[model samples]
Target: MANYQEHAFTHSGLLADIPVTLLAKPADLTAMISRFGNLGDAIDACEYWYGPYPYDRVGYVLTTDGALEIPTNVAYPQFMTTQTTGNNRGLYTHELGHHWWGDKVTPYVHNDMWLKEGPAEYSGHLIEEWIGGQAGLLQAVKDNHFRVLREAHLDDGGFQPLSPMPDEHIYGTHTYYKGASVMHNLRGYLGDELFRQGMRGVQIALAEQTMTPQQFRDSLESATGVDLDAFFDAWVFAPGYSVFVVRERTVNAVNDSFEVVLNIDQKLRGTTVYHEAVPLEVSFLNAEGEEFLADIVASGANALHTVMVPFEPALVVLNRHNRLNQARTANERTLIPGVSFGSTQPFVDMIMYQTNLVDTTLVRIEHIWSGAGVDPATPDVIDVSDTHYWDIGGLWPEGTILRGRFTYAGATADNLDNALVDGDETGMLMVHRETPLDPWAPYPDQTVLAGDLANGNGIVNLDVMRKGQYAFAKSSVNVGMAEVRTDLATVDLFPVPAMDHVNVQLDGGLNGTVRFDVLNAAGQLQMRTFRSANAEGRYRLDVADLAPGAYLLHTAIGEGTAVVARPFTVTR
Candidate 1:
């Protein structure tokens, strides 16, 4: 209205002509043009996928209130008119996309915000894919897939369904990112030509009219000629994503070919699995640097499937192209010390942190499965009722301590292949062991913290300074006396028989120097050593140097609580 500079640009549209112009302050004109430099490309790409622009004219208007899409006219904030690159172009395309998704084709109800914003956000991907090709689209979808997996459940306002969404979170992460993700995965599911036809039908046939979730589903079903009720019910109407675990993967070399059998299980969240309908891409890489892929389809429940390939594969990976929103970060990476680490498969809320030492370490976390690759040996104590396992590994420095707060399902358990026995949450114990050879024991210092238990959920805190292999079991144990420690605490140790190693069971809340001395029967000290520790874990003492005889183990912690002495025999 006052001193606004104008730059006019023109482009030919598929059906309607687009006379594009950029209007901004004199000082901001160059940056604005740079930001909207791809306006013509956006127009052509949108038309190529979504038909006409749906408006008689379109222009970029700079205003105090920017970043909103009006009918045929686009609003841009002067300050936000930065140069477009990488993903920045998406914003411009999204706002312009609203011309097709919302400005013309409106939502019948507020809950249908996904019908408007989802496609509009997806328009950016379409334009990106249209101009940059399939590689760009794959990258875009992968980014969204990982992002949704990382954030969909913990979004700002918390978890909510895409349809009939809570009024407050109508525009939350699930609506925009997950909605766009659904569209991307749907395109992959229904194939390009058919998916495009279905999408264009929604814009062209339902033009200038209001739409609902049901109406959108009907339009797509009519175009694709495929039933989508289960897909919509599981992905849109529900609150969680599909969780998959490679229960077991075995490769055997046949005559010039390889036979690969994948025992896969569909673990649930709040939603059910749709693996039967949706195709999961599995990639197999041979030692000759060649990669082959196969379409993996299974029931929503657990199953064992087999595939035959021409070449013996060295590695096998699933969902290589990022087709679903899942909680499994199958890839293993190092964890930094003192940093809070969570976001694991199956147990999303399980948190582990190292507090005793401050240095880089080789702690890596990977997938949690029914029985990916853990030994199934049981000791004298056996209670395998509804137990789920998640294993991670890293070396613990001399006295470093690692603590974890385990979060489990409450009632309608949605984790592993089988349900918790009786679906009861009480008496739930989270146990850990060093390896398949080691006996399962309550974490060195274990505490069953109060949690929502009656439903099928509970929490337990434990300090573990050892390599991985943790599980949740539905068994009754004296929670206080669940772990077996050597008779190194008191002069008379009865509950847990003493072993060679000095058991250091310290609570997760304490950090102190643990001192233990082996004294002869004459009250003369034979050997003494100390180690700094925190959380709850144990370490082995070298008794191989001592002569065979009986001795007293004097254990002490901090300043005041240094009064424990236990008698033990060193039979080296």
Candidate 2:
């Protein structure tokens, strides 16, 4: 039997452990421990800012069905798992953060849900960053952005006032992503330490009590010792995102640096003017691979400023992380090589996956290409001449390989001509000829005449294709294969730089059973496995327990066997 009573004990500020009952089985003991540990970490994080844990005898229960329920005495979860992926851990962390931000410092009503939901959501993200790192945090933000953009209806007018409850369908947008975005903006405005202090103050003020959003705001102001009305008005109540465009840039020969200006535009669309300090990151890379970074702030629309940074950069990129949606003159450029026959299938697949589809009465085929990193001089080089969509030329950078498949109508030979390249145009295009599939391959005389579009003659149809059908593009590129050197020889692990979890696809090569171990930068082991004659397949290993820091996965197949090591990360 497991010590269920001890695991359920809630620690007060003074470290007093109260006896409690365990409402789970022995197999669930590990999960119970993890939950308690998370709860303890949340308590510590909150206390580091506020004061200390204010409650006693806190109970955590796992509910088989329904959403999470957080009461003053207990937290009942609708789901619990140690699988390391999905929203389960995040949801758990957010609910635990509510112990400090909502349950303790209660939000008076549902209208001011931001007070309860925003901080909690922000806390979950913070915890994710702690365990998953920068990539994980950025991915979480991206997921939130995508979710809100897909579900929320901006035309319904800017965010609904924090008083009336909006429809639950909009919950993911209004209460989660938008709310978290506001908190994130506020954190940027007040700085990390000050913002944390403000959070602590709010918790202390509402200890064992309830407060309105205004009261919480007042507490934050008092704690941070700064005014935040503008911050609140712009983020908490605003709709849509701020757009920043790179207007112009100039290089200074004397200093061997560049001066760039950014134009911030606001599309309020009849909404109140948003006034909040926005931080922007600018990056410039020179021909020699040298890079320089500069940070700037924009307080409102039409805010223009110039900053001089070291290095006569060949390319300048803004918002490198895509943190904000903006139209910039100097967006990142990509090289797309002209496509021809005998090109690598993976390369063709990549082009097809990236290209947008243009359909007309002429033909129907998939088009894949990338616009990012396109050379500005040749902004519209991939022109479709004599074609219905002549204006459909895509942006391509120098040295980029372009690959795609084209099927010509069997009866009508299409004239697919390659346009001549000029000084302004410097990229290759490779087009593959695909035969129409036979409805009955083994059956004789079972073929169909597929329509095709030729040079300036037949109609052409270009449709955006989905991914996964093509092979890995970079594999066949001249970029050279990635060097795989390992001190260990007997074990092999693939799919390096994986997202969620690392799969230990063991092959016991020559050596019998292998021992797999994953260690962090601090030389701390995260996971260990002992396999016997393992096949060449995926073996899931959870890395969510490990912090965002770097880690090494070492596999020892057998005696006199080689040890293979790989680096992997867990992204939320």
Candidate 3:
């Protein structure tokens, strides 16, 4: 027989009907009983949606094993009760939530584990909001979103659909985090009442029976009378999240009214159509600083609309309330909904995917500049043709090579030379300068990727190893001659898409003792080593143990930290 202390907590009437019991070592009886309120709170949250805890009694057994829903009881790890890094109550609510999804109704097959685990996981975040507040919930969602994006960047697992999961990844991020994300997205999409009714009805109907995905879908459909097939396809069956951007928004004054014209773009992470049309909000402020809202539904890849407002709007923005799902995180205007972008594609006038300048971390490119921010005089060699400038500023290390595809589409400014309305990239060259004081120069590795002179559409692949003023000009202009950086030691990694090991090459500027660090896509340090090298040398880094995903190489020269991060990937 096992020797253990059993503590019964009626929870001062909180769980009087469903008396809660905790069994653990004699030394921990007092601590377990003190935290018994977590269970009561979980029951309240679950019952609020699922109608009540299905089990007659609440029970938990403290063990070394991770938390699990074992019918009437939960096998909870001892450390979770005092976990400071994460929500400890979340652990409680998750297992107790399973009492409604798993204990009451089981999945017909293990493949359908998402049905129970996903809702349970989603409930954990909801409970955080329940006991704490919206701030708690937001932090929880932010943590999950970053984890999902980073994991997806790690192995593309987070993008996979919930059902038919690979044997090894059935319990992975897609099943739990994405599952929770979809639930949150649906709640926002359906509004609280419909989503609650749909979920509560489904949970009740599937009681005491094996549940399937379709069975769950049918119940929700019957309850709401809103066909959910499209929702399910885009969110559940599909492997990627919907990506939408406010491509263009223009306002013009009419007789006693303001007409607002908007152009919206949509693209799935890995596909074409975004089947579900979640409600999109456009907020406007008038002269008196009063807010007026207009709602639209995001339908497909491209949508254009005109709305009439009663007064001239001072400003307009998308999702002012931040009511949409938090499937990704952002820095300022950076809103990356999926994997980290090493090879970033920033929509000129759209949201950013926070691209970390120091590493290979995926980030959104935000247009954080305004016309009056820093107007520069014409380049030293401005031809008779009108020349325009686009400001660029962000973090960068000494000798870092910044290369990317510069794409310009959609005509905003009517300046003829400002766009490709009818011009061509004949001698068209990409130029940059550290600031307005420096001379403009041509960046290296310039190749014409795409050019549509007629549509004002074109893309040029080029590299500018430093952050500065950039502009497109003809070859007739000669501001400064350049290929790449010639400053501080430049670091470059070789054997891109590396397998066994990768080589780090140093050239131009670099010498003395150097600190080399490796970081996963999430920006977590994976390995660190020191090397003494000449101004130009090579060092080998073993990456066999690292998972196949995006990574960054951080090199520091001498006592001064000159961070030059070059992204590399590992493969099996």
Candidate 4:
């Protein structure tokens, strides 16, 4: 009950020359607090970005549990209680931001909790990014995006609107992470200088008073002098993301000019479809391979447009900056030599998500196609590498399917880490089509696979993945099967492509103690359990909530000897 010593001390510091105190439990937190010093640097950073700190004295109460903001004093989790634990400076910065956000300028109504959490969250992100540069900011944003998507995935159906969200989902991703993400998106929409000016205006307008979503929007409009009603409607009030389907595009070279025709549709799923007001950037490379950029606003159904160019356009690129949270990422359509990879007609679309970090590169290749050939355990017909993220724009008379593959070379481990196609959450890695006549309903199981990622390889198959459909995938922790060494090798895991529940039976039971653990591809622990060896050595595990993907099963005996590990997959 008492392996560690717990003491308390009050350390005085200064932020902007204001008397600040950091009271830590276990006394050991003194070093961490001292190292981090006063909140001066963080406060200065925020002031430079956001406005001035509105509080008199900033004091932090460090406890081993819980975090809450209380006017002049704030309580934070004691993550800095031990030297072994890295200082949670991020958490400290985030809570500190609440003094200006949650306390000073609160939301007019509880429904608009985003005003508090979003600004605070974004502040911490901004501070860290300023200190650590682009990589840090990118990682922060990526983590935020992942959190939002994860929460959305776990949601009963999917993401709800940020504004007027159901009470149950009020504190969910839509309000916190998505709220911050939308702010970042706005920054992208409005150039940095303009966005910064608008932000300053918001802080000044809503200082020391509760504000509503409309009031906040009005502040931004007042500062930027640009109509943001559409922006707020699409990103804030709307419940779903934008889905742009390239119905058709034609490029013709006249005597002295080139004409381009584009037909796009914004047919999105969910109860509310976001009518985004974003610039569509189309790039054309002349015969000399020089690129020219053109911007336009294409909205509504079947947006037909014509572009005139003075030179011959060899290749065209659309939506280069990825300004939209597109349901489908594939924007270019291309020819794949002799491979019949796409649909006969443009029946499917590919949405790819890629991220590169130190020692890890993740690419999520997803195909949205329709047809009868769709099966759950769809074999890899096209290599993912062969497919491009371009919606070729109806260029092919006989369209083809897309394919690609991923290899683990120089990776830290062989395990394909946290990898999953959000659209195919079952980890089936098969083509998922929309329900016939019902966009909200699930498409019938085209085919059932034997297990989750049967071979443990980063391979994908979208057989009969029709044209003009939508699909998405992401790089989850990609990892391979972990190697296991044990005398009791007769462990049996059945229902390869497991559903509902998985059964485990061992021929040779451990005589001592036994434990079990499940890990996702990213090597993150998912589940843990303790089991006593019985006469039959049978274990039935429920897996209804586990997303579809490759997972590792670890069995440990007394003191870790005679340990065994196996790989298994899950499908919805």
Looking at candidate 4, the ten consecutive residues that score lowest on lDDT are 438-447
The lDDT values for all models are 0.63, 0.46, 0.61, 0.55
Order of all candidates by TM-score, from best down to worst?
1, 3, 4, 2
Across 29-138, the per-residue lDDT of candidate 1 in tens digits comes to 88777777667778887777677777767787778764889776678766666544644578878888888888778889887688878888887887778778887776
Which stretches of candidate 4 lie above 4 Å from their native place?
Answer: 1-21, 34-45, 80-89, 156-158, 245-247, 252-261, 267-269, 274-276, 280-294, 305-572
- What is the clash tally of candidate 1? 8
Error of 4 at 247 (Å): 4.2
Once fitted onto the true fold, the runs of candidate 1 whose alpha carbons sit more than 4 angstroms away are 12-17, 82-87, 127-135, 250-256, 272-276, 329-572
lDDT tens digits, residues 284-355, model 4?
Answer: 666444667777676664477788877777555555444444443332333335423333321122232211
Q: Supply candidate 2's per-residue lDDT for 43.
A: 48
Clashing pairs in 1: 409-456, 409-457, 410-455, 410-456, 410-457, 411-455, 411-456, 487-498
Error of 1 at 46 (Å): 2.5
Q: Is candidate 2 or candidate 3 better by lDDT?
A: 3
Estimate the TM-score of every prediction. Answer: 0.62, 0.53, 0.59, 0.55
Count of clashes, each model = 8, 35, 13, 56
Residue 377 shift from truth in candidate 2, angstroms = 17
Q: Tell me which of candidates 1 and 4 scores higher on lDDT.
A: 1
lDDT of 3 by residue, 1-572 (tens): 66778877564333246677889888766676666656666777777776656767778988877888886678988876565424667777888888888778778888777888888998888887777787777666656655664464235333587776667777777788777877777776777789889888887788788888888888888888877787777777767665455545678889988898888665344444475666777777664457788888777767987889887775555554445543223332222334354344322322222322443221223221111112233342232222233444333333334455555443444332444333543335455555545555544334332223334444544423344545555444211112223355667788999997888887745555555556676655554444555555777766665678987777655543345667888888
